[model samples]
Structures are given as C-alpha cells and as structure tokens.
Target: MKDETKYSQVWNLDKLYPDGSASTQFLDHISHIESKVFSLEEGLNFFNTPKEINHSSKVADLIDNIGCIRINLSQANSYITCLLAQNPQDQNAPTLKGKTSSISARFDAGLKKLQKILVKTDHHLWEDMLDTADLNPYKFILNEWRKKADMHLTDDEESLVSDLMVDGYHAWGQFYHSLIGSIKVNIQVDGERNELSVPQAINLRSHPNEEVRKESYYALEEIWEEKKEQFAKILNHIAGFRLQVYKKRKLENILEEPLMENRINEETLSAMWKVVSKNKQPFIKYLNRKANMYGHTKMKSYNFWAPIKNTNQKIKYEEAVNFILEHFSQFGTELENFSRQVFNNEWIEAEDRPNKSMAAFCASFPISGESRIFMTYGNRITNVLTLAHELGHAFHNHAMKSINGINRQYPMCIAETASTFSEMIILDASMEKAESGEEKLFLLDEKLKRSVMNFMNIHSRFLFEERFYEERKAGIVSSSRLNEIMHEAINEGYVGSFDNPSIHSWAWTPHYYITKSPFYNFPYTFGYIFSLCIYAKAKEKGKEFEKDYLALLRDSGSMSTEDLVMKHLGEDITSEAFWEKGIELCVRDVEEFITLTS
Candidate 1:
C-alpha cells in the first residue's frame, strides 16, 4: 500500500511566483524600486534648506515614497531568498542574489543620505517631520533611524563601508558557508561506510546507540580539526573588520552594537545571566540523572541529546499537523485558524531530502501577509514539536499583519517568544496525555534536555563569543587558543557537569560565521527564559490571557523588549526577581524529572 501521509512533501512556492522563473512582474517591481531609490537620493538635495526640508507636505511625500520602496524591496528579497533556500543548487539563484544585492546597496546609499539629512536637521524640524500625518506609519522607523544616525559616519564614508563590505567583511562569512556546505565526513555504521554532511553528522549525537553517537562525534571533530586553521583565519578577519569599523565610529565596547541591535540594555542581560548562572545547579543535577540512566559517570557533549529510550510511537506528518492544530485550538480559535491556513496553503517544506538545509526557520512576507516554514520531518516526537515551534512564528507574523510596514520586524531576543511558547503548549499537553510512566519519563527527559541546552549550552556559546572578541582585540587568536577558550566557556556553562567538554564546539557553530549579528548566542537564552515566564502567566490566567498574548506578539515589532514585557506581563525584565521566577519553573521541571527517574 502506498500511504500518502508517510511520504515527505515539498512546499508550493507558486504563492511567491507563478514558477521559479523570474517573471515580468518581479523584474518590473525591482526596476520600480531602483527608480524610487534614485529619486529619493535626488530628494536629499532639498534638505540643504530648513524651509524646504521642514515643509510638512514635502517630508510626508518623501516618507511615503521610501516606505513604498521598502515594502516592494522586502517582497522581492523574500521571494528570491525563498527560492534559493528551496534549491541551493539553483543556478539562477546566485545571479538573482547578486542583482538583489546591487539593488539593496543602492537603496542603502539613499538611506544613508536620508539619515544624514535627518541628523543635520534642527531637532524641532525633525520632530515636525515625524509629526506629518502621512509619515505617521513610519514614525517608529524614522525615530530608529535618527538614533542609528548618531553611530554612523558621513554619508560618503558610510557608502564606502557598505561597498567594501560586499567583498571584504561579508565574503568571509560566505567562504565559511560554502566550506561547511561542501565538507563531508566518512563514518562506518553497522559495518558499512557512509559519508555524511556537517548537519547529518551533527544529528548523530542524538542516535540511540552510544557507539554510533561517539563515532559521529569523533568524525565531526576530525573534520573540524582539519579545517580549524582556515576557520581561525575567517574568524580573525571578520572580527578584525568589525573592530576597525567600531574604531572609526569611536565605539569602545564590542557588545554595544549587538545590544542595540537586540533592543536590550546591559542591565537586563546581566540580570538574566545572573539568574541563569544561579540556576545551573539544578540543571547539573538533571544531567547527572540523565548520565546515570545512560550508564555513564558523567555526561559528555556527545551524550547531551542522547535519547533515554526509543519510543515506539511514530507520528505521521498528518497526525503531527492535526496534533498541533488541536493544541493550538485549545489556546485560541484564531491561532487554530492560522495553523489551518498554513497547512492548507502548503506553506511548509518538511521533506527529508539530500542537499537541503538542515535547520528550520519561519520566513514571513509582510507585503503578502503570509509565512513559509522550512524543516525536515522524520516522524519523531521532536519533529512534531519543531512544527509547533515554527507555526508559533507563523502565528506571530499573522498577528502583526495589521501592523505598519518596517515596524513588523522584531528583534532576536523577542523573536523566539512565540516559538518557545508553542513548544511549551505541546510539551505540557503531551506530558498530561502520556499513558504510561515510561512515556511520561521520555517526555520529561526531552523537556529537561531542551531546558538544559538552552540554559547551559547556549550560555557557553555566549561566553565564548564574548571572550573571543576581548582576546581578538589584542591580536589574531590561534586555532588552539580558540579551542581552549571554547573549552573554558563550556566548562563554565556546564558547571562541572561534564568531566571532559567538547573543544571542537567553536568549529561547528554557524553563529560565529554570521557577519550580520555578533553575540547572537545570548538571545536564545533570553527568549527561552522570557517565554517560560509568559507560559507561566498563560497557565495562570487561562483563557483571559489569550488576547494579551496576541497583543504581545503584535506589538513586538514596535516597542523595546522591556516595555513589551511590562505592558503585557507586568514584569520588569531588568530585575533578578523576574528572571529567578522563570528559572524556578525550570527547576520545578528538573525536580519532577528527578522524582520520576528515581
């Protein structure tokens, strides 16, 4: 019998375009944006005179035109990216990407000129510009631009930096991406040799058999070891370039830019970490119990994701879809309807295939008011939770549909809130429905593993990145030194839970290679903890909280992280008390796992 539900399905990209081929509509839109960007650049000349610049009609029209261009560019860029992600081997993808990059560079040049004009304008006139009725929708974006303008050089210098970044700074990131994608490692499983990509090898850490997991770990280590020197050079040049840029801007702290990017302050970050650090003992205890179950003295990096016992329960894709919808409905009808729209529209690509990307992401198109989720589903419980996670992101986008353009983009810190909250919903529901102690234990184990990873593993990555930047300021850090720093960070994060930590950790994390966002690791922890707090509130308030939760998601793009939390949850993010409460919920889970195992 051929079961349709058993097979993996490719997503329908026709929603973005009639076909993968570039159509006249796409080309015309790109041309229109290019012309608009050029016109905006010419409009910058009007800013020379306060009278002309302060004319409310002139400023309002300019803002509206810029917003239009931004929306069109975003839609086009999203389409190109979706096409590329669907098929990395698409020959035309590169050409289209280069063209898009050129368009983006030109737009950024015009934006720089605009920023200079706004920065040079008198304070009252800039306020008047913002107060213009037609510019009301772009108030948040314009205000943000004014703040960012303080950190930038002159328009010409900024343009030069943007131009150089194409081949200079960002090329290092591109090199790392290409290298990792092409690299493969050979491993023997069940007396047969198999070659695996970087992601496939990494996935083996969760294999049921210890030998296979350990072998995969060593195989990955060997591959990364061989490439460590090249990786070191890439890291050095990327960091050096950032430091040079920061020096030009006279920004002393490396963390400053990332903090601003994440829309958070130092106090909030410190408070969150302090609570996380204090709560590490409970996680270490959970790890100890897990290691004992695995018949080991202490848990190693390879054993972190090791399954406690294999479950016979295999959830088909359809079953998983229904499962997520049922739980989402329990939260709200709106959420349930959103999930239905995603599944019915075939907006998800869950096929397990060769040469496809190994990670999952939810990309939302603001102009179209739609989202596409990408993941590889293999009928595991984890895959079900991943679907729920990505759908959470989709729901967030759906909620923000009514929000103005450019204001729909949220920071990474709050970005994970909906996704993690979705995981919590499914995790709790699954735990409640488990028919046996064994099933319950497996669920608890999975839950604990996730918490530990988010709280500890992610913390280690943050620590390593922080120290790397500090040391890199002196000179180029060697491959061995990178390993040493990674080991130290791991040890610190693990809190002695592991007798020997993974040194090759630095080599595999693609976060380090991402030139756009440095210190990208800490935001995961922030989102996890923040979501936990929100989840606790949802449980407490029950049905009444659903509206507020939606409101939180809708406003995520418009407010600061702290303000968002305060408005929705009535909590101060900068206080240790709030973070400690979230940690306590995690500790309760750990305590429950200990009791079950005992």
Candidate 2:
C-alpha cells in the first residue's frame, strides 16, 4: 500500500485571506459588511419615489454596493466552509458558521427592500435599469427576480421568514449535518473489533472483501434504523417549511422553485426521465453480470459499488496526478495546464484521516478565481478519476472567472457537465492503457459502474423524492411510510437487480436534508447524460471540439440550461430525441461491459 500521507496535501487558504479563518482582517471584513447592509437598508428608503427610481446613476451605485457586499460575504463564507471541511472537529467552525449565517440573513433582509422597490417600479424604469451600463451585467438576475416579484411577500414578511429560518427551517439541516458527522459505528471485521465514522463505514461498501462489505452494510443499516425517526422528522420539517414558504408566495408546484433554480422547464425534466426509464433494461443486464462476478445469484444493495476484481497495481498520488494530466493534455492544453496549477498550488485535501467530512465536493471561490477540492484518496484508480472529476469543476470555474459574479452562478443541472466530461476523458484513456484482459475488464467495470449509477441509482433517488414530495403535501410522512416510499422507488428502478432492497435508504441521504436546494437528486442524471452527449460530440470532432466545449462551460452560468445546450449543441432539451441520444450512449457502455466481461 502506498503511504496515504504522501498523497495528501493541506490546501492553502492564503489566497482567500492573508490570515486564516481567525484572522483579524477576516473579522474586520465581516464587520464592514454588517455596517454596509445597515447603510443599504437605510438608503433604500429614498428610492421609493418615481423620480428617484429613474436616476440611473443613483440606482447603479446602489446595485454596485449590493454586489460588493455579496462578493465579500461569499468569500468569507467560502473560507470558513473550507476550514470546516478540512477539520470538521474545529471548535471555532460552528461559531463562525453562526456568525456568517447571521450576516447572510441581514444581507438578505437588506436586499429585500431593494427588491420591493424594483417590483413596484414602472416597467419602463426597469427597462432603463437593465440598459444602464453599471446594471446591465446583472440584467439576467434582475429580470429573474422581476418575474417572481409578484409572488414575493411584503418586505417585512420576507424578512421575518428569513430571520426565522436562521433558527427554524435551516437549523434542521444543521442538526442533520451534526448528527451524521458525529455518529460512530462499531462493527467486527475479520475477528477484530473496529470503530468507524459514518463516512468511513460507508466507504467500506466498495471494499474488496465481501464479509467486510456485508458487515459494514448491516452496521450502517442498524445505526440508521436507530435514528430513523429523527431523520424522518428532519425531512418532514424541512419540506414543511418549504411548503409553507411556497404557499405564502402563491406558488402551486413544489417543483416550481427547483425548476426555476435549475433554469429548466417541466417539459425538459419529463423528457429526460422518459428516456432514462426506457433505457433501464441494459443496466439490469449489467447488474446480473456483476452478481455473477461476485458469485451471487442476485446482487444486493451492498454490491452496488463493490469492486469486481482488485488489481495489484496501486496508483500513488503523484502518479495519479501525472496520469490525469497526461490524459487531459490529449484533450486540450488548457485542461492540462489547469490541472498542473491545482497540484502545484496544493488546492486539494485528499489525505485519509479521521474526522474529515465524507464524500467529495469541489468548491469554487469566484472572488479569488480559484477552487478547493475535498476528498479522501486511497491508492486506487477510482481516486484518480475522482481527482479528474474535481479538476473538471475547477476548470469550469477557471473558464467562468471572466464573467460577472451574478452570471457565474450556474444551476446544479449544468454544474456537473464539465466534471462528468472530464471523467469520460479519463475513463477512455484508462481503457486504452490497460495491458491485460483482467485489467481491461476492471476498467470497463469502472466505466459501467457510473452508467449504472447515473441511469438506475440516481433515477431511483429522483423517483423517491418525487413521490415523497407528493405525499408530504398531504401530511407528515411517517418513518414507515418513508421506508415504503424508498423501497418502492428502489425496486422500480433496480428491478430484479437486488435480492433485498434497502428500505432505510431514505434515512441516510444528506440530499433530503438540504434546505436551500429541494429536489436536488435528478440533476445528477441530467448532468451525466448531458455530459455524455457532449463527450460523444468531442469524440466525433476530435481536437476541434475543445474550443466549443470550453465555450459551453463559460456560458453555463449566463443562460438558462435549455438555452445553453441549444446554443452550443444545437439540441433542444425539451425534445425526447435529444435525451434519447444520451441514453443510447449509456446503453452502449453497458453492452460493451457485457461483451468484455463475458
């Protein structure tokens, strides 16, 4: 085994702040933002008059101030979040979290006044504001707010809801986060007693040993069972709070906000799922093959990420970096250069250590034009792919650095496009480099694993959330009901793939607990297929497609998902034909896996 320490590097936060999280400068910046928010609130009182609203210079100045405050607040929040991710046990992290949350609340409270003014302003004046040089960059953002302005409550009511959320709605999410981060599982593996965090135990699902995987699965199930009720309450409360807010805003569809947030319509979402449902049979075939590889009559929930076979070659961290860079260079010089900068600057924390957060995410700091990636890397090819995945996010961010802040915030649907595209590049390169049949089979399995996940596993999550939300509208869903819903969704998507379904699946997913983004599950499937289609285009066009791909990434934040895809790919997302193309690509991979393994 490679020394895990050699592969790990503590990311540098100096770019965000010359001093770390506790730096005096950071605190002073927060105080400055607090004072500015108050001043902006006071200034909004003058902008209510028609004549004052038409003063382009004055309105432009106010917009600039708001933009500055938002950028600074984002920078500080990113710093604290980075610190917290690196050391979840940090005593000061929670305190800073509270402080930042309050600052955000205050800022939102102040922004509501400006929004109210815009809502009441004459349409002609609004047009003038959009055309103003200072405010033109934010035209898209302002127009979106204008579209929803009528649905908004009075400023006082909105402010009340925002403040209450700090303690009420959002607190539930925090509670869930704390519970997962602190929970420990005790399981006996190979005649030795072992204690693991929730994340560490979950990682064992991919372990090579069957007994360890089974033990870890049961241990996780037991722990989740014990907390099922609490998890249920958290989900209900979060959904309940959202429903209440939506009702007050006069919104009917629970999906309306998420759709708007993702910049896609119901037609597009429906089309994507229709194509996915039709393509599920191939994945089922792959699952059956996977079960045979494991010497089982049928697969189980624990077998989802299980390694088909283990290779003796272990990829070191430096070797992984080189491998990623080499493949990326084949695509474009820009991609390779960006990956090198990430390694040289130590922008990743991939060490295997205790108490670190579970799962990997790439966080981009637009203010500093940089990104930070968090993941625990062991010497595995999966780790190499993960590194490429995150670097894809950084590369996307790098492309968007030139855009204004408001335009740079892409929705989650398109957010995974670049990352998934990067994974495709890495997978193809690995398959080409594999020397033996066993190695080729292993690599093919890895590629097929993602197809299974995006097509079947994530489809299950989407079905579960859709049904849960529909049920939640009537009344509070009991724990048993949640389990039933989850089981039905899993069985529907994974039909005949699992001998026994995971009923407690709903209890452990952190996505259900996110208060800011509701119905966050389907975006993974959307991004995956979307990226696959883009990757196929790149393959057909050779190096010529690189420029177009980068252009798509740069424009991702500025337009709606439909518009972005249509502009770059000339494909309408609302059409079933467009989605079918992506689904067929996934099916092709499954067929290839079967051929290689057989």
Candidate 3:
C-alpha cells in the first residue's frame, strides 16, 4: 500500500505564480518585462553623450530605478528557472524561459549604455556621485565599471554584443541543457531494468553499491561518447565566441576577463593555486586511504564520490532538517530561525522524481526577499548535506535582504563562502558527536571528499580551461583533443590515484558550459579555503564571531574581495600565507583521518 502521507515534497509555486508558466499573472509579468525593457532601453539613450555623466541628474535616478526594476525581472526569471528545473518536459516553460533570456539581453544592453556613461565620468565627479544618496549604495560596482571600462567597444558595439549574445553565446548553454534533459540511459537497478535521465544516472556514481556505480559509469560514458561531437560543438562555440569577444576587446590573456569578474588579481589567483599545488600530496594520501578501505590499490573515477565504510545510511527528511537546525542553533538563533521559516514556508522543492535536475540551487527573489532551494532528495545523507548547502545560500541572501538589489551583486569568488561554511557547521558538529569509528570514518570521508574536490577537482577544471583556451586560440579543438585535455586534467588533478578515470566528465559537467561565468571553477576553492579561515575564526571567537560573520555576508557585494576579507578577518588575500592557513586546516583533517583509520 502507498503511504498516505502528504509531504511538502514540492515547493509552493503559488507565491511566485499561481499557475506556473500558464498563470495569467506570469504572462502579465512577462508582458510587463517586455514593456519595461523597451522603456528602459529608450530612456538609456540619455547617456549616449559622454558629457552627460558630468551634467545629468537623471543618471543617479535611472541607476536606482533600473536597479529596482531588475529585482522584479529577477523574480520572474527565478520563477521560470524553478519551473524549468522541476519539469524540463514542460513545453510552455521553455518559451517563458526564452522570453526571460531576451528580456535579460535587452536589460543588459541598457546597462551597457549606462556603463559607457559611467566609464566616461570624470574621476572627481564619479567620487562625488558615489556619495549621492541615490547611488551611494552602488559605489563598489560603479567603481568597478570605471576600472574595467577600457575593455568596452563603442556604446553601440557594446550594445550589439549584448544583443547578439542572446541568440549567439547564451543559446549554446541553453542548447546543452535541453540536450541533457532529453537524454536517457537504460540500466538495471535491483534486478529490474530501468530508464533514467542523464542527471539520474550521474547521481548513481555516488551509489554505495560498487556494481551499480560501475554500471552507471559505463552507461553514462557510452551515452556521452555517442554525443561527443555535439557536446564538442557546444564547448567550442561557447569558447570560440568568448575568444572572439576577447580579441575584439584586444584582451591578451583569456584569464583576464574571469579574473576581472571575480574581483581578484592574477597574484591572488596564483597564490591560491600555489597553495593548492603544495597540498595535493595530502589529498592523494586521503584518496589512497579511501581506496584501500574499498580493497583497491587504485580507485576508479566513479568511486571518487562514493561514501566510505560501505554505508548507504538514509537520513529522513524532517530528521535532516532538525539535525541541521540543531547544529545551526549553536552559532546563533537568527540563522536557525531563518532556516526554520524556510522549511515551514515550503521554500524548497526536494521531490525525488525523474526529469528533475540532479544539481541543487538556491534562487533568491530580490523583490520578495525570499529564496527557494531546488534539488532531488531521497532522504540520503548526501541529500541532507546538499539541503544544508543550499540553505546556507538562502541565509546569505536573507542577510542581505535589507540592502539594495544593486548592492547585492557579489562576485562568484565570495559567493560560496556561506554555503560551504554552513556545511562545515553541520559536519563538525556531527563528527564531534559520532558514536562509532565507522560513523566517524563516514563523516571523515564526507569532509575529506570536499577538501579533495576543492583542492584537486576544481583545480583540474581551472587547469583544463586554462589549457583549453590557450590551445583553442590556434583553431577549433576536435572532440578527440578535448578528451585528451580532459584526461590530462583528470590525471594531473587526481595525481594518478584513479585507474579508470571519468574522462567523459567534460561532456557531463555543466560548469564548463556556463557562458556568463567564464571560469566557473576556481571560486569553489577560493570560497572553500576562505571559509575555512572564517570557520577557524568562529571556533576561536565562538558566538562572538556570528555577528561579524553575518555583517560580512551583508557587505559581500559592497567592497573589493580583499577589502571585504580585511574588514572582517584582517587577512590579505594576495599573500600566499593567508591561503596556506586555510589549506593547512584541510591538511590536518587528512592527518586525522589517517590516524583514525589506522
């Protein structure tokens, strides 16, 4: 008999739009966006003249008003993204998502016009404008505009780039996603043949059963191998479009744009990678320990994410929430209280269903000051951890609810700080209270897995992209070459720990295809170690650090990455020693795991 329990398995879309994509209210919102984009585009023409920056009072008001409108636009887009993630098969949702994409392009074109004016502003007047009531909150972004302004072409050319990007660059990313959604693999689970979405098969790579993991891995590779050429096209076209853009902008180094977007200098990035390179040995030791426990001299790539101790412990949904909240309360009531509200408010979609995305995300509605987390949950420990991670993002957004929308545009480097930090709070607390060696080892694997992922996995992604772009400069890279690059990246990244590597990972991963965030890689390591340093401080300072921590999250968008860290932690990001402190913390975890397992 089926259980009669009616769990809040799906999030409430009524608050966003009563009827999802078909909602009359949703159509009204889309129409409003179309109209607003037109009006904003026309009004942005006031800044066509370079001298307008010095004289126009309209610039400040326009900036504030446009920022306000962007919040509503984001709310609408968030709804569509949630809808699409829930049901990629929905024909109506795709059209609505495309409308949002078009609106986004027009919206970005208007911002470029505004950026051109800001670029041409006199330094003294720009400083004066930052002090104005209307634009004061947007100082950091305004300054960033002027600092990176030289890369821009003429205003019209810049606008054209944004417009063409709608169907040109971003469309490739959309294409990959659509393809992935339609893909399915046939496999046997529990003595029964089953059909699974690409995302579902990928998730099984973490399954505790070795046969299941191996079967899913081979099935995944076969499917991805079949479609390698099309995947290559997606990767090539996206990188090709970017390279051409950089060429037109006279950008010499491909990393220049990603570095600039991340609000970090080459030196800071180098320092982080330097520390990561030095710590690779420790991570490999942890990996070897994991392999030995599973009776393998060398682990396969599919087993990399498999939990140790042969455990497939299921953590119940409500139990996971209570477990997270119990640990979260140790830090402060506010975070705990906010998390509770999120749970009770049905702000999460955790239904375990086919055709749903495997990845988890926390999307904030800037206008409503709320956030919704999306994921495929199966009451597993991994699912609980993912819930905590997304909830951390939600809490971060909640912390900044009082700030203006424009001021909340933080870079990707600092974006994962809260989410990673939140995970640690639960992990550390759980480890401290574990009853058995196996239980502790299981938790140890969870912690060490993250360490290796950030230290090794993300580093490989960074290295792969760095090399890919460098080689791509010569010509379009063939599918075979992409595999070579991916194989090399994986081999070097894992330090030869795996016998059979997941080389086709290049096709299965979405981060490489994200057009907006070019280098969607290093920031994971940055946020990981950076938050380790923060977590260390919280340990030393106890509850005293919570207030400053929340304050830091609030100020994440309003300052340089270095300045933000210095203000809260008095650390210099450019220095190697600062990153070393955090990496050392990870090293110590590996050391403890070794001792415990021995």
Candidate 4:
C-alpha cells in the first residue's frame, strides 16, 4: 500500500490554473500594466503639485494589476518548475526554464521603469498623493518607499544598478544553487551502498544507527571538502559585491542593509539573541545529558540528531492529517475548518517521489485567492510536521485574504511565525499522547535538536555573514580568510562543549554567503522561540487567543517585527524580558526530556 502511493498523487494544479490559456491571460495582463505605466508617467508631468495629482488612483490600480500579474506569473513559473523538478530530463523542461527567465527579465525591466519615475517624483508631492490616494492598500507601500529615501538613487543610476544586480548579485546565487543541487553523496551502510541528494543526506543524521550516522557525516564532508575552494570563491565574490553596494551607499555597518530590508531594528535583534545566549546554559546541559543517553561522552556533529531511544513510529498520511486537524480544532473553528479546507481542496501536494522539488513550502496566490503546498510526504512523523508547518503558513495567508494587495507580502523575519507555531502545537500534542518513556524522550530530543540547530548552527552562519561583509568591504576577503572567519564563528557557538574530532566545516554550506537572502540564519531562531511564546499563550488562553493570533498574521505584512510583537503579545521587543520568557519555554521541553530519559 505504501509503495502504491506516489508523490504526484498529492499535487493539485487545478486550483492554480484550470486550463492552459491562463498563461496567455497572464501575459496580456502584464502587457497592459506596461501600457498603463506609460500613461501614469505622462499624467505625472501634468501635475504641478503632488496634492493636485490624481496619481493615487492610477497607482492603486497599477498596484492591483501588478499583484495579479505577479501571482499569475508565479503560478505559471511554479507549475513549470514543479514539473521540471519532478523530471529534469524532460525535453520540454529546458524550453520552459528559458521562457520563464525571459518572461521574468521583461517583467523586471517594466518594474525598473516604473521605479525610475517614482524616484524622480518629489517627496512631499509623493507623500501628498499617497495620503490622498483612494486605495488604502498602497498607502503602506508608498510610505515604506518614502522611508527608504536615503537608499534611492537617480533614475538612470537606479536602473543601471538594477540591471547590474541581476547578473551580479542574483547570478551569484544562481551559481551557488546549481552547484549545491548537482553535488551527490555516496555512503556505505553496512553491506549495502546508498546514494542521496544533499538534503536527503542531511536527513540521514536522524537515523538510529551510529555507524550510518557517522558515515553520512563523513560523506557530506567529503563532497563539501572537494568543492571547498570553488565554494569559497563563490562566497567571496558574492560578499564582495554586496560590500561594494554598501560602501557606495556609505552604510557604516554591513548589517544595516539586511536590517533595513528586514524592517527590523538592530537593538531588537541584539536583545533577542542576547537573551538566547544567556539562556544557553540550559540547552548546553540538555545536550550533555542527551549525549549521555546516546552513549557518547561528548556529542559530535554526527550525534547531534541521533535519536534518544528507539521510537519505531510511523504515521500514515491519512492518519497524520486526522491528528493535525484534531489538534488544530483545539485552537478554534477557524483553524479546524481551515485545515479541513486545505486537505480537501487540493491545496496540498504531499508524496515522496524520485527527483521532485527537494523541499516543502506554501505559496499563496493573491489573484486566485488560494494557497498551494508543495512537498514529498514520505509518511514519516517529520513529514506530518512539515504539513502542519505549511498549513500554518496557509492560515496566515487566509487571515490576510481580505487585506489590500500590497500588504500581503510579509517580511522574512516574521515569515516563519505561523509555521513554527503550528509545529509546536502538533509536537506538543504528540508528546502528551506518547505511551512510553522512550517515545516521550525521542520527541523531546527532536524538539531540542531543532533548537540547537537553529541557535548554534544557523545563528553561527549569520555571524559569519556579518563578519564576512565587514572584512570584504575593506577589501576582498581571501578564501582562506573566509574559512578562518567561519571556523571562529562555529567555535564560538558550537565547538565549546562538543568534543567532535572534525569541525562542522561551515565553508561547505553555501547559505552563509548566498546573495538571495543575506543574514538568512537568525530569523529561524527568532521565529522558533517567538512561536513558542505564542504557543504558550494559545495553550493558556485556549480558543480565545486564536482570534488575536489570526489578527497578528493579517497585520504581519504591514508592520515591523518589533511592532508585530508589541501589538500581538504586548511585549517590548527591544528588551531581554520577552526573549528570556521565550527561552524559559524552550527549556521546559529540555527539562521534560531529561525527566523522560531518567
């Protein structure tokens, strides 16, 4: 029966596009946007004052049209990408990839022209037009633009910068992506031979066999070590490019660019991590005991995910769905019904297959007013957690469904809030229902493993990015220098207690220097702990808090992370108090695992 099920069985593309003509509609819509932008530009010339300008109405209409165009374009691109990922060797996939990129470039040029005109407009005039704009939806976006006045360059200069950005910054990311995806790992498991992709190889760390775990770790390191120099070159080039941009803007701190883009204050981030660092004693102790349980005197990177005991657990997909929906019902009717809708409506694509998109994510389409989940569910306990996590994202989008078009795009810092919160609920429920000591210990260890990876592993990478940019700005940081900096960051975070002979080899993972999202690591920890705080509230307040939680998700796109925390939880984000509280909640699970193991 398990073998009979396939990954393709879970995908429902009909919700995204009912027919093939949708691509034509999408092209026509974007073409019309290009035509209207010319008219909008001409109208701007007729107005002497921004207050007298009727640019608001036109801008609002344009924004809506653009949003629709994006959603449709994304749907088309995603469909093709998913198909291609399922079978890259498909002859039609190559043409689709080229066409997708060409379409994207054309759309990018149009946006650049519009941005050029907007940047040329007088600030006060633009403000007045924004205030007078009939569409309240665009007010937030326009205000954000004005806030970034310092970042604006001359129209031609900005266009040139944008053009350079694609080949320079973006291409670096593309290169790294291709490099990582092409790499394969071969590990010897007992008498058998095993081969896995990068993600799958990483997942093997959770396997119970100590030898298998060690073999997988060395296999990963071997592949990465072979590519280390070229990988370092890629990292250096990307960081160098970013530093040049920062230098051009005269930004004093390298972190300033991503902080601005994240719509967060540095004080808030520092405060959060400071509390996280201070609370590390509990996690350190937790790891020590967890290591002892696994019969290791000191934990190695290989044993980081080693199970605390035998679980022998399996969750069938249907049974997993029932468990998710049952726990969600405790939140309220909205979540309960939303889960049902997601499962019933072809919103999810959950099946494991060879050569599919390697991970899971939820994408919301504004025009279609729907969400699509993409994953290869293997009927593992972890797979169920993935579904619950993605559904949380979908629930977040559902909360924003009635909001204006421009406000739907949330900042990355808080993007994982809903998803992690969902994971907490599902995991907590499973722990509560565990029938044996070992089962409880296994669940508890899994949760702590997540916390450790987020704080120590991912956070260390973020620190490396910061230092890399700082050094790169002064001059190009050599490949050796990059690895040295990475080693220091890793030692500062993870190397303290672990007596592992081999280091984590942080240079091998490309996320540290990926240009797609610089400083990409800390947010996971933030979201992880932040969701814990929310989950705590949900547990205490019961169904009553669900409304507030939904409201929080709806406002996430429009507000700063600090404001979101303040508004939803009434916690001061620039202080250690809230973070301390969050860390205490994390330690509770650690404490429980200790008890379960004893």
Pick by lDDT: which candidate is best?
3
RMSD of 3: 2.6
Report, for every candidate in turn, its global Cα lDDT versus the true structure.
0.83, 0.83, 0.84, 0.73
- Candidate 3, residues 308-392, lDDT tens digits: the string is 8765566677778889989898787888999999988899998777778656899988877899999978767667788889999
Residue pairs in candidate 2 whose N, alpha carbon or C atoms collide under 3 angstroms: none
| Native-structure RMSD, model 1 | 2.2
Q: Candidate 1 at 91: error in angstroms? A: 1.8
Best by TM-score: 1
RMSD, one per candidate, in order? 2.2, 2.5, 2.6, 3.2
Model 4 pairs whose backbones collide: none
* Candidate 1, position 503, lDDT: 90
TM-score winner between 2 and 3, please give it.
2
lDDT rank order: 3, 1, 2, 4
Off by over 4 Å in 1: 1-9, 49-57, 127-140, 353-355
The positional error of residue 134 in candidate 4, measured at the CA in angstroms, is: 2.0
lDDT of 2 at 326: 84
Lowest summed-lDDT stretch of 10 residues in model 2? 1-10
Model 2 stretches astray by more than 4 angstroms: 1-8, 49-54, 128-135, 352-355
TM-score of each: 0.95, 0.93, 0.92, 0.90
